[model samples]
Each structure stands twice: as C-alpha cells, then as structure tokens.
Target: MKKSLVLAMVLAGFAATSFAAEPAFLADRHVARGASCESCHGVKAPAPGAKVSSTACMNCHGSLDKVAERTKAKVPNPHYNHLIGTDCQECHKGHAQSVNLCGSCHNLDWKVP
Candidate 1:
C-alpha cells in the first residue's frame, strides 16, 4: 500500500512540473546542440534585458541573402521584408515566445520560429 501511494505521488509530481513549466524551445534546442548562452549572446556577461543582435545570428546563419534564398519557397519570404530590418530577435526570441512581427500589419499567417 505504501509503495503504491509513493508511486502515485511521484507521477503526480512529474505531471505537475511538466504542466507548470513552459519550455523555451529555441534556447533548449540550442543548449541540446552544445550552444552556450554566450555563444548566441556573444558576451561573457550580457546586460539585463539585452537582446541578441541580427549580426550575431548572421555570423552563424549566414547573410540575409542566404537566409532569403533558403526561405524563398515561403509566401512573401520573411527574410526579404523591405519594411522592417531583418532583426533575428524580432521573431526568433530565445527565452520568450517567438512572434511574427509582420503579422501585426499583414495577414501572412506565417508562424515565427
């Protein structure tokens, strides 16, 4: 009886923790692939609320032209946006949920990240 109770409690605890925490998908994926925070941030100690720059992303993901070429099949290719500058953090947020900033003005229906 005691063993059964303990097992139920353990399962409940695991379920609670999993349901309570929202995973940072991008950050977790990077960490899984051996990417440290400093690798993406490009600093030993980043400032509070400091954002990652597009140049930093380009350093690893290549130039804007290359990214646009890769996503050329997508409708209205996000990398080719002329209205807003290509800011990686604008859509590919590391710690928070990513958003399609273009969706604010256009009805592209593209999912960011």
Candidate 2:
C-alpha cells in the first residue's frame, strides 16, 4: 500500500514536469500569428502575392548567390530540399525564442578550415 501511494505521487510529479517542457514546434512566432505561407499558397492565390514558398525564397536566395557575395565564400544550397515540401519555418525558427537554425545543417565542426 505504501509503495503504491509513493508511485502515484511520483507519477503525478513526472506528468507535471513533462507538461511544463516546451515543444520546438510551438516556438514559431509566424505560426502563432497565423500568417503562414499557406495564406498565399492556397487556391485562387495571386502570383508572388499569396504564396511565398521556399522556391520563391530561392528564386533569389538560392545557389548561395547572396551568401557567396556577402561572405565571398561558397555556401551549400541547404534550402533546395526544403523548398519541395516544407516552409521557411521548418528549419529557420524565430518567434518567442531565437535558435541556431543554420547550425542544424552547416555543422561548424565539419566546416573546411
């Protein structure tokens, strides 16, 4: 009986702690604001007006053109695959908290020195 009571208390405490943990998907401010690209990607959307897909971001930002010019060094085209099905928010996150987005793909440890 005593063991069971202690187990119940421990379970309740664990549940409370788990609920307090913050989820990564919930950290995006753009999603919270409801201004997702779907607003533009939806049916009857205008050209370059409603939908701002990653392809759109790449039309100019892709091929590392901008990054190369800025840093004078070639960078990987990380957004190419992301344009197929995901949004800018998939890896690059910003809202309630800031995170290291590019670091996910461009590992500093693997960078050619």
Which is the leading candidate under lDDT? 1
lDDT of candidate 1 over 1-113, digit per residue (tens) = 69999999999999888855635577666766777878788887878887888887788788988988999999788888675475778788887778878888998787776
Candidate 1, pairs of clashing residues:
none
Error of 1 at 109 (Å): 1.2
By summed lDDT, the worst window of 10 consecutive residues in model 1 runs over 19-28
Q: What would the per-residue lDDT of candidate 2 be over residues 1-113, giving only the tens digit for each residue?
A: 69999999999999887755534443233345554544434444345324345554455456444533554443444433333344654544333333445566657332211
For model 2, give the 10-residue run with minimal summed lDDT: 22-31
Query: What local lDDT does model 2 show for residue 17?
Result: 76
Q: Residue 17 in model 2: shift from native, Å?
A: 1.2
Global CA lDDT computed for model 1: 0.80
The lDDT of model 2 is 0.47
Query: Model 2 has how many clashing residue pairs?
Result: 2
C-alpha lDDT of residue 96 in model 1: 73
lDDT per model, in order? Answer: 0.80, 0.47
- C-alpha positional error of residue 110 in candidate 2 after TM-score superposition, expressed in Å: 30
